[model samples]
Target: MVTLRIATFNLENFDEVPPNVRPSLAERVAVMRPQIERLQADVLCLQEVHGQERPGQPRALLALAELLAGTKQAAANVVTTSGPNGEVFDQRNLVLVTSLPVMARAQLLNTLVAAPMYQILTANPPAPQPMPILLERPILHVELDLQGVPLHVIVVHLKSKLPTNIPGQKVDDFTWRSADAVAEGAFISSMKRMSQAVEVRRLVDSILDQDPAGRIVVAGDFNATSDEVPLVAIRGDVEETGNGALAGRVLVPVENTIPEPARYSLFHHGKGQMLDHILVTRNMLAHYRGSEIHNEVLHDESGAFATDVKYPESDHAPVVATFEFA
Candidate 1:
């Protein structure tokens, strides 16, 4: 049996900014290099990666490839598909692989449903209200041949839960804006995230339709809790009806393999949260061995950010999963 280890990490806008910034390129690479080395994954799914402007331009991903040049996990190929537009803000998804060859690759952006600018409200005073909007992010899909086993990997950075106010409307525009209005904004964000999750589920269905026992792995920064609607939608939890005719075959969250207290991948406002996740299809789960969340690399001995860590590596940690295949 051959064992393959895979990991998902958000580099936090790597190689796109100028060196004059708080955390210079050198500073980020210094910490990121060791972290990647420690991960030692056969294939790595990276989010928030900076893409190349033109076909033949110098890419930030190449710089990252250089960082891993002499490492044991040196990638033979670094793959990143073009986003909807040519490299906007250098935000994109990237895949780095060592020995396994990427048989095929694609970017998924148009499959997700887009939310309209406004929705109709039925109330005492009906108004054309604004709903949470969905802005598509490029999802990196790559098919890799792991020891002759076809493995489909999808890398995603779903819509965040940040409150987005309507156009020409600020959060504090009016001192007395109703609490309902504020709550509406929050609901919109959640809706956007849920839409992305549904799209991912659709993608999974498409793959399974062709091959019932397809090997698939979905990994990324979900930006929502495991029990949240967004995650639940991706997991495809269908309540069992006595008939057992329409049961959904959903992906399993690999975090469950680890201990509860140590599963968190990020700390915000002093609260530890598991924002990063690695979920695999039922077919792939049969070979699943174990998983880990590498948070120690982001902090020092005293659980503080590493020295000269202006950026602190990333707000989130890397999650890795291992599987055995023949």
Candidate 2:
């Protein structure tokens, strides 16, 4: 059995820039390097990495990987792409850094459609500003050979509280028969994205459909709570989400790999919110022995090893899970 530590984190504002703050990439990398090294994840998925807006800025992700590899003695093999949208604020989707070599690589696997009513409406008291076009977030997939055996991995960062409604008025808020119409419309849009979530489910099932015993793992920074929406969506029932599915039925939450809320990857305004997760199949969990969402590396005050130097590294903590692979 081979134990592998895997993790995912928002790495909040990897390129956060204050209006007056000069773009200081090295300082940011300097703060995060140690925490990243301490996790020592065999597979690490990241969010919010920024790059050249006008082809002149430095590459933050690779440079950090270089710094980590150089300073902390980490040799992370890394792969990443810019955001799917042409104007994604120079922010990228996912940077999958791993020591384990990947078998297959794919990106932007799916997208959700908006409620039709939203498309037909015009902004009430129309804003002097241009409207926002609704966009579905991207999902990244990579396959790796874990100890000579194959494993499929999918990484996703879904949409935030972004409503699918047009500006000034909810589709129903401004139109005729708007009450139930608006509520139902918004719910339907939610269901659409949720359906997109199920698409990944079916995609996984399709893979296991051909190879019933195939080993697969889905890891990401899903914005929803495990029980609230995302995890339960794929887990088959509207109830609890699980670690595996086999023979066409969604399996129970075996191995209980993902921990409770206290084990979260992000904090906001002093409150802890766990938005990162790792869901594995029974085939993989059979070898799974350890799992924990690590925050010790944050280097924040009130935490074990607090330091202002490390405090500015990132707002989100890293969630890690360990399992033996064979």
Candidate 3:
């Protein structure tokens, strides 16, 4: 039997800024590198990693490369989601790093599910036509060979609960002009989030249809808790689906294995929440050894105090899970 450790972390807008920036690359690396090293993961899924670009050069993960420098993962195989132009996005790119051999890799954004068209009820002028609720980021899918063991991993960074900006909706960036605008903007955001969730669920089902016992893991910052709609949609719980035959396809949250008090990965308004997750198929549960959330030093990032302070470390903690596959 061989043991594998998987970890997911949201670096929280990890990128290079000007020299005068509050949190320099060195400062972030000092805090983040140790957190990553602690995981000792064979496979790592990262979200919110921004790409840096220079004139006459393609966008690259320079900040990420610097953070992984001299580390085990620095030399590992890396795969990242790119745009239609076949280039990595300038911001919030999903990245997967692994020491194991990568067998296949792909990305999905509105591929399995078509984006729904909706007319903004709060459009500045009279609305003309509906617009597609496009995804801001794509899901990174990779198939790895753990020696002879096949492992399927999907990394995603779903849309945040922050309301999508609608024309004439906001007085400023954070301030809304009225409650109606806030509600409508939030509704549109929810639609996009739910659509992405359905697409992920469809991809999970497609894999299971081909191989029921597929060893699969979906990991990242879902931007929602386990009891939320996105999690519910992807988990496909037997109780919710009312089908025992589909139980094998159900994905279980690894964070659930941790104690209630220690299960959270992020703190908001002083309350702990599990936004980051490592979900595994039920068949992999037998090999599941344990799980951990390195949140002992996590801080709340909800109020003015959080905004005033430049926390070197990411607000979200790194979550790791272990499995022994024979």
Candidate 4:
């Protein structure tokens, strides 16, 4: 049997911004590179990776390249989600790097489900008609040849818990003028996040419908905990479906196997949260060995007092899982 390691990390706002403006690329690399090295992953799924633009050239992931400069993944096959123009966005691009042979790849954006339309209840004038709720990012699906086995890997970076903006409700970035507006904004954000989760669940169903025994693995920064709505939507537990026959279609979170004390991948206001995840189909879970959350150096990014803090490393910790294939 051969073992394959897969890892997911959210390099929080990873970019080549000016050093004086934010942490320089080299500074981030100095700290992040070691984390990448520790993962030793055969397949790496990355979120919040910014694309860089150069004169007369399409956008490039310069920052990511620098981070993997001397690592084994430096020469791996890299794939990223792109916009309608076939170019990666300037910020928060989903990336997948793997040494295995790639069979096929696709991106999902309102492909399975149509975009929902809703009227803004908190707009200033409240006179406009309903508008389409567009997804901020696409779900990346890649088919890889892991040795001789066909493996389906879906990478996602779902919407954050931050409230969606209302036309005239915000007093500032972090403050809202009206509590009602804040509630509406948060409702809109939850709608968007749950919609994205529905789309992902539909994609998973499509794969399972075509190949029931598909070796599937979904990994990324879900921005939600295991018990949250987004996860519950994607997991499709048999209990929720009330159909035992659908048990084979369920997806299990690998982090559940890890000790609760060491299960978290991020710290917010002194509370540990498992926002990053690696979920696999039961067929693949049979071969699962163990998992790890490299969060020893994690520091709280949110607190009561506001203070400018610059961390060279990413706020999120990397999560990895290993599986052996016959």
Clashing pairs in 4: none
Q: What is the lDDT of residue 267 in candidate 2?
A: 58
Candidate 2 positional error at 68, Å: 3.2
TM-scores of the models, in the order given: 0.82, 0.72, 0.97, 0.97
| Global lDDT of each candidate | 0.71, 0.61, 0.90, 0.90
Candidate 1 vs. true structure, TM-score: 0.82
Model 4 lDDT-worst window of ten: 303-312
Residue 273 accuracy (lDDT) in model 4: 96
CA lDDT, candidate 2, residue 229: 70
* lDDT over C-alpha atoms for residue 321 of model 3: 96
Error of 3 at 315 (Å): 0.6
Residue-level lDDT for 207 in candidate 1: 81
Candidate 2 C-alpha error for residue 88, in Å: 10
Output the TM-score of candidate 2: 0.72
Q: Candidate 3: where is the Cα deviation over 4 Å?
A: none
Flag regions of model 2 displaced more than 4 Å: 16-23, 53-63, 71-74, 82-89, 109-122, 125-134, 162-165, 168-196, 237-261, 268-271, 296-311
